[model samples]
Target chain A: MGLIQREIERAGIATIGISIVREFTEKVQPPRTVFLRWPFGHPLGEPGNSAQQRAVVLEALRALYQIEEPGTIIDLPFRWRREKYADYLPPTAADLE
Target chain B: MDVTRFKNRTLARLATRFPRLAQRFIDGYQAQESAGSIPWAVPKPLRQAKLALVTTSGIHHQRQAPFDMNDSDGDPSYRTLNGEELFDDFQITHDYYDHTDARKDPNIIFPLGPLRELVSEGLLGRLAQTHYAFMGHIDGRHIPTLVEKTAREVAAKLKADQVDLVLLTPA
Candidate 1:
């Protein structure tokens, strides 16, 4: 989607991406980007968790206004608590098969 | 371990073993679960709870317009999952949708089956009459209007049906 953002930017629309992974997105280097250390499937954060979603969304929206130069990336200060990661693990091949 | 080092090592391993699969898994997991649930000092009572699933799988009826792939490749906002029933013969088109290797399984993406299970178990209050799908790649150009329109229409329909939560599932 970063590519789309760049297109939009090329079309004269300012764009910002709220990416979970900084490394990959940094490579694309959109005009403005925000990296949050969040899990996949839930960009704005867990189902039914609106506040976090709103904050993340708002922050991304804010980046559109705050950043002046192209290719700006900012790492959000937020981190998930350790306990949350305890029961959570990426799926394995066995589960997929 | 420090967070940076931990994420770097984990991502590096995924990148080496399963680059495409790893991207999908990490994108899904990190986008939502990485930070845990965002805390709300005072959580608002859900205004509209009739739930639905929106994905980025570029799923659409063969007759409907396909999501713009070019847009998906560039902008994050152009991707949306179409909200149509899965065809019995439907097959995944992208390697990124692989969930089999995930520890939690890929049911997290299309939880419709699980949601049905939950419904049978009486875990949810009620299911919306319909769910939604959208490709994950969207460019955000004119998307605010589109999303608002979609959300409003969906919410209205779900509210009419008395749905209390919209479970957004990104594939």
Candidate 2:
């Protein structure tokens, strides 16, 4: 996945990837990434949990803009099965700008 | 006797259930070392940039050909996905991970559901009509094929579509 992201970013479109395994992301080093220490097949969090999923998507998009250095991987703070989505602060337009 | 498939599935289940076990598998598998300047492109603001999703969760339309599970090296090919129609009929075909949860709700791995919600809320500008999916688990001889051929092809497609940014997910 990181290899693919590299190719896409090389084509001049910004890219951000969500990585379940930190080691793999570290090795491949795509342009930008957000690492989740969660299980495989659940990068955005639990099934049917829209709030949790949205929180992740928001953070990943934020990473796409915030990361100035290539190959930077931001470690996300959300914990599996323990996060409170109600308190999760998404990036507002002002924040992103 | 599909011993290899059975073995891979068993390992997947075990790894999914046990993170410690998953770590061992991660340690054993090595990604090719990448050296050199990483790629870069200035991103447009979230509310104005055209975005797309790319995933390696082995997802595809129900009618598309399933990725090959017989090869241990894994499938290097990709499937074109239509964001507007994907959730209506989609399936996952990777054997390297237990996709039971993803099957229940693909947003966990694909996040198209959330991405659409963002577009509706105006946090994102728009989604490209086309997205992409790969089976991942590609290794050995197939890595070159993924990096050199299929991935670049998808990149070119994204470029042609004028996507400003892409969000990638992995299984």
**What residue pairs are clashing in model 2?**
none
For A6-96, candidate 1 gives per-residue lDDT tens digits of 4333433233456655665655554567776655443444444334443454354344445555577778655743224333343222221
Go through the candidates in order and give the C-alpha RMSD of each one to the true structure: 14.0, 1.0
RMSD of 1: 14.0
Docking class of 1: incorrect
Scored by DockQ, the top model is 2
Q: Find the number of clashing residue pairs for candidate 1.
A: 63
lDDT of 1 by residue, B69-128 (tens): 333232232223333445432333222333232223333344445445434544333445
Q: Rate the local accuracy (lDDT) of all candidates.
A: 0.42, 0.91
Q: For model 1, what is the alpha-carbon lDDT of residue B132? A: 46
Window of ten residues with lowest summed lDDT in model 1 chain A: A88-97
- iRMSD value for model 2: 0.8
